[model samples]
Target: MRCQPERGHLVYIWTKNNQFCALCDEPSGVERDLCGPCEDELPWLHDQCSICALPLLVDGMACGECLQRPPAFTRVETPWRYDFPLDALVTRFKHQGKWPLGRLLADGLARHLLHAYGEGLPRPDCLLPVPLAKRRLRQRGFNQATLLARWLGAQLQLPVDEQLLRRTLETPPQQDLDAATRQRNLRKAFALSHQVELRGRHVALVDDVLTTGATTQSLARLLRKAGAARVDVYCLARTAKPGD
Candidate 1:
């Protein structure tokens, strides 16, 4: 059950699962794992671009960059802005090997996606987690995107193809690169697996966070070339554009 907060207190409480808030370690007084205060403090996104999901001055308007040159993906759905506790949670989940934190974040994202689907967002035929390069996968011992995709697929009852997309090159992290360089670095970084047919299929690309969207765009282009009819991106958070 959902708890609507009023003046920092839970207005409606249901269930007593005794789950503790991942952030503050306080008892979660609601049905969900997060306590009412933490839930209320999530960095929710609003007034964003329809195509890129970038925070905008006004809602339902495409960002200037998107209007001039739209990316391969047709739409993006992200529930939170990349900031504060959300950023800390993602960093811990991705780099520190915190599986519980990752699972919690995935659960929240799945709920948001279900709500969006209820509000008429088109569901994709299959889900593809943004793949990790062989070197990184070996170094990390697991792919965070793959884990998130698995959880979300289970929650949504959607098919997930982990082998459909493969990263061909070990490019540097896009976080440190500028937009132009990021795009150039990822130009030939992805490939479609052999014997995979995407013809007339809609695919959702899943990832942990979307910063500049270079990686997603690269994979989306490859999917389109392999005959995907539509590409949509799903992520936990979206980082605001620099200086926006």
Candidate 2:
């Protein structure tokens, strides 16, 4: 049975089930690990760029950056804006080894994708999780993108090609970098596996978050170079333009 919180209460008590919200510790009122109130508080992205999915001032419009110079990916889809609690959740999932939180985020992303496809968004032939550098992989013990993609693939029944992409360079964290610097840092960072056959395929690159989009652009260019007909980006959230 489905349930929702009434109003303004942090501690929701549901006697029927023992599930608690991942974020609030309240009784879960939804199918997922999130309580209704906490889920509703997530920063959902509404008006966004058609190409990049960056939060925009108006709906159904591309941002000025995308209009000036289009990204390599054809389209981007994200369920949430990278802000507040969503950001905190992502940080915990990515850095703190919180697999359950990652699962919840991936579930939300999968639902969004399913709804988008139902609304006529073109589905891709395969999903590719952005590769992590060897050093980062060793340090983190897992690639968060791969974990998200695996969950999403199972939910969507799409093939996941985790081996198709490789990160050759170990770049510094992108958080402090400007757009131009991020792009340069990612140059030649991704290379396609020689064994993979991507010709004429539409592929979606999956990631935990999209900041300046430099990473996705680099990967999409590599995919296109490897003969992927179309490259799209799927991320959990899209950050608003830097300093916005």
Off by over 4 Å in 1: 1-17
TM-score of predicted model 2?
A: 0.91
Clashing pairs in 1: none
Q: Please give, for residues 60-124, the per-residue lDDT of candidate 2 as tens digits.
A: 99889999998889999999999999999999999999999999999999999999999999999
Per residue, candidate 1 scores C-alpha lDDT tens digits across 79-124 of 9999999999999989989988899899999999999999999999
Q: TM-score of the candidate numbered 1? A: 0.91
Position 196, candidate 1: lDDT: 77
Give the clashing residue pairs of candidate 2, or none: none
For model 2, what is the error of residue 150's alpha carbon versus the real structure, in angstroms, after optimal superposition? Answer: 0.3
